[model samples]
Target: MSFSSVSPSPTNHHQMTEDEMTSENSLLADRLHAMLHQEFTSYPACPDYTSQADHSSTCSPHSRRAVVNDDWRRKICEWAFGVVDHFEYSREAVSLTMNYLDRYASYAQSKGMPLSRKSFQLAAVASLYLAIKLEGRNEQGQRLTISTLVELSRGLFSVELIEQMEREILTALRWKINPPTAAQFIYHLIKLFPVEGIYDVDAKRVCNGILETSRFFSELSVYQSSLAIEQRPSIIAYSCILNAMELVGPVTLPCDVRQAFLTRIAGITQLREDMMEVYNTRTSLRELHSAITDAECGLPGGSSSDANQGTYDTSMLASTRVSPVCVSGRQ
Candidate 1:
């Protein structure tokens, strides 16, 4: 299917009656709930195994080795985000790319093939390439080209290698790549808010800012292996939105109303204690939150003290060296 075919239409900003707004919100929420369930069911099995203590020991040795620690994964994700920014890809592209990487890696592990650092990086690049092709489009609505992707990689990878890796990833994943991401859920979640009527201009703006900020945190969570692998995407989306709302302060909805909304979301998403654990970890992790804040502020050329900065970061990430062949082969 064409990217434009599935792309979400912009929310109509025209004034509407409260009942109309509520009806629209209900329909969108139902669709989103169904999408969330589909994505949750489509997740690779490794996430479930990782969440279970007894099952951890049963995982193959190669699987264990392929699972990079959170620190390295964070650095890799930061570097990948830089590339995504350089190419002006949407956050959805990044989210989808990360999803591909995690699922493919898990599949490889299931087959007793651990990915090396270099292999993992290659997988990330390949996933991004696939995501851009699958989700990105130019102003004229043309799909991005392979040469452009090769150039973006700074010649670290050849087209053949990427093509080969893409094939391998697809084979490993059995070609399932359209899984819903946290960004999608966030978009739908914001729609659930009553950002209509005369006063909605500022309210909508605030909600958009909150959604963008939450997306940043959600993308950051992708690198934290535990949260990325263990928690459901819906949970991550919900947590990030809540965290962003906290940062933005109460704007459109009152405190009690917000709580009630959250309760409804939790019930709809069927969230469990693990969701709270993920949220608590994200909010309490000072370094991660600070890094995300800096990254978000730096996006719009804002200074460190600017809390109300713009979208995702555009700054180049600090270089972290890795050997081309430091680790062994994937198989």
Candidate 2:
């Protein structure tokens, strides 16, 4: 007899028992509460300067309008995402890096310090470096050295400049480096699915698909300047899930199960389908995902091929409007 014939079938593998569901819910509740509490504390404040004074006008040359803005931040976000992907590092680290950069930018602007164009790029590199060290490990399980970061900058910044920028970011962020990113929230929120007593393997597979797609949406959200300005991780996370669910539609994911899962999410996050914020976030993510898809199809080599090759072509990336950042090697 074959081994399969002798062994018993594990039919209950996809089923989540009541006790397990309760335990998962309790743990997720506590974690989500802590994330919401810190969300307000570490969230970036809105820029105070709306209108830019003319360069020849009475305002100082280093006005907030003349310095860093959402465009610059968006470029850094794109570059950082490519770097993290090139190194096989966790993309969540990119989100965390943006958290550092955005909060630091707000603090600097509030304090009357000019985040010069050069300083912004330097700060972005340092932010990514710090985030990677905190949460990423190479294939060999080693942290990348400062020298690697300098090389990634193409020697535009030396070790000393990178170190100083890192220190400045830390000080400005009050050393509270850990922000509850949308990607983190996505995983936690997915745990609240009403999976109790469900034994269908197909159902489990669909749920997992939704989760992976939701994470992709979260990654895409990192590149949107408006989403960064919105600064609500929990809502953003909820919106990603909702958009993913819509993209999957009722055909693949049964309507009853989908409704139950969404109900559980709304109960925990207080995010109603009718709320304007949720509607806007979902709309933005859907549009962004569509735009990215169109852009990728136009590229010479698709993102999947580039990822498999373990390198990003700076030339091709520049064609996508991403800033020139050296990410030419594996970790």
Candidate 3:
């Protein structure tokens, strides 16, 4: 990027006025983002649909996801039951360090390298460095000793390599990551009206976006399942990581992450087909009302209690995925 890209312009960065800072920061990051995204191997930019979408006249999208499809199945595999397994593993210092690293991300985005906000993979410190940086205490406001970070990052990137890779990683993400995350998806999904909302002049889309993203999530899960088969962790864990970013807000993807997602997509295509099966049936309006009454009151002859228990996911992803956006923070 041009040095001017990093520097403030007279028209833009005249001073640190709130309005000026906001605009300048946005423009600067745009420039840096443009520079970083020069090399993207763009593929068909659509969700594979996990074969969740039926081709036959027999099955409709509504019937597919509404009735037999297992949304919880995927959500459960990744985040763990009733708990955030990842956060549990994190130390206070670790969270503080991630926050600290994120501070740098804000700094990077504000200054002109939208890199940090765009590519979280680029944001990861080496596993070792990350551990130390995340959870160390020294009187000097130091967390994770420097020696520790160095030891972890050493193989990933040498002192010299760290500089280049850091820049490159950020650059790669600028090319691929986009805003609107899975949490956003879940939010809209949960808030979704039974009917599609439309404004004739413009046409508004809501859970529609998640339609595509849902497919991606399914594909991601199937692919991850294979890679992580009885290994360190499931590939689905990465999906959880990405989804957590959504939970935290803002979705950025490193170019590497994009490639990884796509690779998983291919692997998942087969797996998803095998794992997901579509049925061609739907309850009539009367049938639906009866089922709803039975489910709501826990009436006899209803779907079993065990069936309803799956809805207890506290990840926020579960509760909100089917609803439309309410007031922001999930209650």
Candidate 4:
């Protein structure tokens, strides 16, 4: 099938020919398909504790109690994001860190022995430290050292503790260190949108803004303990993108074009089969985005400025450390 073609935008100093566009789109479609398959295959089993409402509050193997409640987990997530931001690491590191953390928690809970708050904190630190090594680099392209991470823990944890916890986390996760992040899925799925018609200046800017806004939701999803634990990354990414479109597409896109884009995204993600799941997730994200907007602007009950109109400045969140790192047996 012949792919749709478009006039080159000024942003492209060199434009691809029709054949190049076709080949690139074909390659992207293949990668997207592969990712969709892989996302579901090795997905970590959600802890029984996460899904149940009444078993027991004790952190037992058969208990329905969560190893870490969402509020505490959210704080740790903020701290981890701060660590990555301070170290100039990619935000993807934060995503990987959380993946390790959630999966290990599930593993522990499944074994009838869940981690305590202090133990969970230690595990979180170790997971962040390990994820940095796997995903980050300094100005000199050097990975962060264990000693540095230990120091960042306010000397609460020793090098031995961090090292040992790293091994335990890796074992619990069965060394699946590279779980697909929602951000990875976002970039791939964005390519499925037809590039042919969005070359106009306003259209291009609005489209780019949609992707950026979607990325904001994807990052925020990392802070949501249940979203990633319950949903596949592909679904989360798709839902985020769709949410962004609902917020921005109507502003700049013609009705027909917006509908086409919506249709295209649904086809790419197979939204028909998972309509209810995606709808629920999108509703959650919409509420999340609304709450963030209100919180950012200090509004109580009314809508404030919309970050979806343009790119959101996440540097404030990156710099804010919510709480101290709790160490096991610390005063």
The 0-to-1 C-alpha lDDT of every candidate, in the order given, reads 0.62, 0.70, 0.30, 0.69
Prediction RMSDs, each to the true structure: 8.8, 8.0, 20.1, 6.3
Per-prediction TM-score: 0.70, 0.78, 0.25, 0.80
Each candidate: how many clashes? 0, 0, 16, 1
The best candidate in terms of lDDT: 2
- Model 2, span 1-331: residue lDDT tens: 6465454346554354655767877888888888887787655434422112122223564554456555556667877877766666776888888878777766786787757767778888889889988986865577778898888877788999999999989988779988888988889888877654345435566666667767777877887767864548887888888876765544455668778887887777676778888899998987887787777732232243332332233332223433335632223
Best by TM-score: 4
Model 1 alpha-carbon drift over 4 Å, by segment = 1-23, 44-68, 139-143, 152-156, 196-201, 250-253, 271-275, 278-281, 284-287, 291-331
**Of models 1 and 2, which has the larger lDDT?**
2
Per-residue error for 38 in candidate 1, Å, reads: 1.6
List the candidate 4 regions with Cα displacement exceeding 4 Å: 1-16, 48-55, 58-67, 139-142, 249-251, 272-274, 296-331
Worst 10 residues of 1 by lDDT: 322-331
**Poorly placed runs, candidate 3 (over 4 Å):** 1-156, 173-176, 193-305, 309-331
Which tens-of-lDDT digit does each residue in 192-261 have in candidate 4? 6654565443665666666776787888788766686777888788888877776643335455766676
> Model 1 over residues 1-331: C-alpha lDDT tens digits?
6465564434433434555867876788688778876765766325522333224434786644555545445566666666555545565676778778877766776667656656777788789889888866844466668776676566777899889999999988888888877778877776655444315336666666666667766766676667676666777787777766655434344566566556666666665435556556556433566765666633222132233332323232221233222112221
Clashes of 1: 0
* Candidates ranked, most accurate by lDDT first: 2, 4, 1, 3
